[model samples]
Target: MIIKPMIRSNMCINAHPIGCAKETENQINYVIAQKAKRGTKTLAEGGKAPRTVLVLGCSTGYGLASRITAAFEYGADTIGVSFEKQPTQVKGGTPGWYNNMAFDKAAEKAGLKTKTFNADAYSDECRAEVIKQLKDWGAKADLVIYSLASPVRTDPDTKVMYRSVIKPINQVYSGASLDMMTGKITQASTQPAEGDEIPNTVKVMGGEDWERWIKQLSEADVLADGCRTLAYSYIGPSLSHPIYRDGTIGEAKKDLEKRAHNIDAALKAKGGAAYVSVNKGLITRSSSVIPIITQYLGVLFKIMKKQGTHEGCIEQMERLFAERLYTADGKVPVDSENRIRMDDWEMDPKVQDEVNKVMPAVTEENVNELVDLDGIRHDFLIINGFDVDGVDYNKEVTDMSKIEY
Candidate 1:
């Protein structure tokens, strides 16, 4: 029986379970199509195959993509650890849990091994439980991917609290067009991050948590030889520097980059490596809300897609696994900034140069022609399978209660 829709702020916060399931299948199909285009020679090569992978922040975005890559691209047995769970009515909604269920169903259909731990990744108790579960399965992970984004975290020891904020570094106010109704950009102001916010932002969003996860795994002896760990970052065009790179969040990313190096050093004796891959921005539930970013991404996506070079989160992850991280050569590529450079192509000077030429002129009147705003918006809705084509959005979606990790 389809469930009756619940009203929330005059908008539908509910998702159709069947639609979500179909969306997951679509993503799997996309991976297969992309692989075919890239050729099988570039795919992850394995004789016995790594049986276990631990993917933190596997609820959405890069983390979810990483899990799919491990299961589909490498045929690894996977365990996804995330705080997201099926939302009870009192607790609001379960966007991540439903997505996970869809992923699990698709993976099972493909004969891939999968499990999920719907618990907080930052909590010691949760980590202990995951380690115990792995030990019970008589398995250790050959790969770990940390891709968490949270606004606040309490130190496990100090119990001190930290909150993340995104602001610009300079005293500048920028204009952007925002959808007043949806709070999305149709196209207003992006301000600079305050100087003092930089260090604090880094402390919160950077690599400290990533390193902690690795350390815990190593201490538990759950890390396999030649294991690799990756965390995702973003480096957009210069136009967003004041609001992103030089902003509070940028400071956090810098801290994250530094944390990767520290993690690498700690793992050296164990023949493990830690890396931070700079990833391209796409329309995600998180990225869409950031000021000015929506407009810029809309423009960028349109330009890149037309040139036959655009990539969504899944595409980027597939390439990261096939072309860079797991390549046969054993060499990880880095850019001039001394970090992994997957996002470099997205921010190519020529591309950004062209984007800049049109950004200032992109008003609502000419937005469709100048940018892929509709595509960007559609991707956002598609994240939850709300606005996808061929899906019956009007169908009563009553299975929310059954979605589980």
Candidate 2:
């Protein structure tokens, strides 16, 4: 079957395998070219690397970029766990599935150790599988990265499925938003969450899963001495606080941040540490669907690009590891909330002022020329293997869904 992008509601249901592979390669290349602009030479010209590293949600966005950086930057052996759909005769696999396949193939060609578990990362069985992989590889992980982002999570013990809400709290949130499906800026609003929305969102997106992973890994003795773990989170500027920072997802993020201390103490007992990194806003499948975020990002991207302060997934993760997390003295600098703030650039006063000036004035007519809609839109599509540079769209793409990784 020939694959073409079928998009709806800021999501592309279909993905091109070749384009997916190409996108994956592009991310990998960014890490490999350490001598380029903002050249990060953390690794001693690729002398030594991490013995073992595990990344949950290692398929898309920063999670996938982290995986590539771990292998390509630090030369670390990696094991990934993610829940992604396999393609069928009539459907295309989730972009992550193809990305993992491409990553594994590339790792093999480069003679790098890489393994992936295509299962629910929130399950006991998946944890067991990771522990088994660690034991089989004869190396406990020195680094563990949790980058899980799911709309729903099933409790392993109670077998209860909780879906997370992204609604604002207290009152309806109205703001300018960029419609990703079309090149238009529009007014977007989200009603305050209903009963149990906050609790449910926390239950689904909170740090329970991160704690579970750390606990299970610690119990299995898969964490090396002085091991470091980090999970991705977001705290955009005040513009998106209603639907992001102070909204349902914000409640979930608060829970996640609170758990960091617990995990840090737990890991400290084993000569290890854990943290939550509040990341910069970028166009991702998850964030694009959120209310009023794309418009914010559109304005943000334009400002940051002009200021030469823009950082994508690879750049952020690269900096996190090279400059922040694993520094010369091993001291990780964090904010007052006891979490790393990679969104520092985004939260800068100058940048926020620029965003605020143009946010309220955003309209369908001027959004294209005024903001970075083209750049933001392309990032969304390229992640799912559409609108990619140098990808042959005219050629027939064979619908070979599964690749043994």
Candidate 3:
């Protein structure tokens, strides 16, 4: 069946099998191109950079990119845990399902071992299964990457579904934002978190799950020596800070950062460390649903592209593994909060100065002239394997993907 992007609320509801394959191939090609970066090199030049990695939420976005980097670049054995919906003949599976399937196929060809678990990452059953797999492999991870983006989570014990909210915690926020779906600049306001909004947001997006993962991995003895973990976070410019950085989500991030310290201390005896990696804001599915951030992202993407600093999930992960997390000299540079700052280029004083000027000027009339909504849309599409080049969109996918969950 011919498939196209069916997007709503910043998410693509359907995916093309062939396009997803092509997208996965593209990322693998990128890893092959950057052979001298983080991947293994011949002993004559340097040496193999071998690792064992476990990635939670390793289906799409940064998690998928990180898996590719580990296996293709560093020749690492990897196990992935994610909550994803697979495709069927009646309907296209989530892009993540196809991506993960394609990744396993490619890894097999490359003689790399990869295992994926499609289940709620918050469930004890899933956690136990992942740990069991790690034990069987006897290749415990040297690094663990947390990139979960679920809106709600089910409590394993209580079976209660807790949904996360996106709201300012202190005051109602009004700002300029782009409608990624329509390419229209719209003014939006977000109300402050009330009642259980703050706590629920923390319960879902905070570092509790991450900390639990660490504890379980440690108890299971599935974490290799010097094993470190990192979770993704974001802190944008002042214009959107009230609804972003210093808002409800920001409170969760702060708690995550604080947990990093505790996790670090807990793992110190085993030579492990934990960190909150503050990343650049891109057109992620999660970010697209936020208030007043889409406009900033569109504008920022345009400026960053012009400045030769545009980066997507793959670029960001590549730099993180190659430079910040793993370097020839063995150093991990961090911000004052001890968080890894991959937003350096995006937050370049010059970039922020330009963004500040552009944020207030954005309006429906001036949206096109001021920002690159197309660029933002391109990002959102590419991440989901939609609108990809060299992929036949007209082909029937009834037999293309035999993926089942």
Candidate 4:
């Protein structure tokens, strides 16, 4: 059957099987090319790199890019955990399912060891299985990446599920929301969190799960000496703080950042380290739904592309490994806050000034001129395996359960 994107309220609810696989292969090919351009050597070549990596939330966005870079560029054996719906013959699954399948297939072709789990990362059973698999292989993870982006999470002990919200803190947040499909702009506003919403948001999106994963892995002795763990975060410009950095989600990020300190102290005893990498804002599944972000990213993308500093998920993860995480002198550079600032280019003074100048002037008439509407539309479509290059959407998907990468 031929598949097309079914989008509602800026969310793509359906995915294409072959398109997802092709996009995953595209990222792998990109990293392979960068290995030569950047002189990236694998551990087999006596280079400093991760030997065995574990990536939580490893299906899409930054997590998938991290896995691809670790396996393709650093030549690391990887175990990935993410919750995704599997496809059947009549219907397609989530984009992540096909992405994982493609990643596993490509890894096998490259002779890199890989195991992907379609299980919830928040459950204890999933943790136990990962630990058992690590023991079975007798491989300790040298790099652990936490990049989970879920709307709800169940507490492994209490059996209570908590859902996260994207609301402001104390005041009503009103911002311009851009419709990527139609180029229409509308005012979107959300009230402050009340009752258990703030804590619940924290419960779902905060650092508790991250801390638990690390503690369990350390106890099970599955973490290698001098191991490094990283979690991804984003802090856009002040314009987006009301709906992002200063919102309920911001409270969760602060908790995650705080836990990084405790985790860092514990890991330091083993010569290991922990950090919260403040990454750039990009068109992500979750980011697409947030207020003011779509418009902000539209303007940001236009200016950054003009400046020749635009980076998608793959490019960002590649630089994280080649420049920040693995330096030649064994020193990982960071900002004064003890965090790696990957959004440096996006937050540059000149870029923000340009964005500030252009955002207010954006209307239906000048929308295309002011923002990279086409660029963001392409990003939004490709994230769900639609509008990707070199893929014939008219072809039939003979089997939904499998893909040829």
Tens-digit per-residue lDDT, 1-405, candidate 1? 444344332234665555555666666777777657755432235333356888988867788888887786667778898776465543434556766887887778878768888887777887898788789888888888888888777778887777777777766646575442243344246555555556656767888878888889889998888788888888788877777887788878888888888888887787878888898888765566666777788889888998999988788888888778766677778765457878877878889898899888877677678778677767766666566566766665444545421
The reply for model 4, stretches above 4 Å from the true place, is none
What clash count goes with each model? 12, 0, 5, 0
- The model with the greatest TM-score is 4
**lDDT by residue (tens digit), candidate 3, 182-214:** 876556788788999888888888998899988
Candidate 4's residue-wise lDDT over 155-195, tens digit each? 99999999999999999999888999999999998899998
Show model 3 residue runs off by greater than 4 Å. 37-50, 400-405
Ranking by lDDT: 4, 2, 3, 1
- Tell me the tens digit of each residue's lDDT in model 2 across 262-292: 9999889767888899999999877887878
Residue 94 in model 4: lDDT: 93
Candidate 1 regions off by >4 Å? 1-14, 33-50, 88-92, 170-172, 180-187, 190-200, 336-338, 403-405
| Model 3, residue 211: C-alpha shift (Å) | 0.7
Q: Where does candidate 2 stray beyond 4 Å?
A: 35-49, 402-405
Error of 2 at 340 (Å): 1.1
Top candidate on lDDT is 4
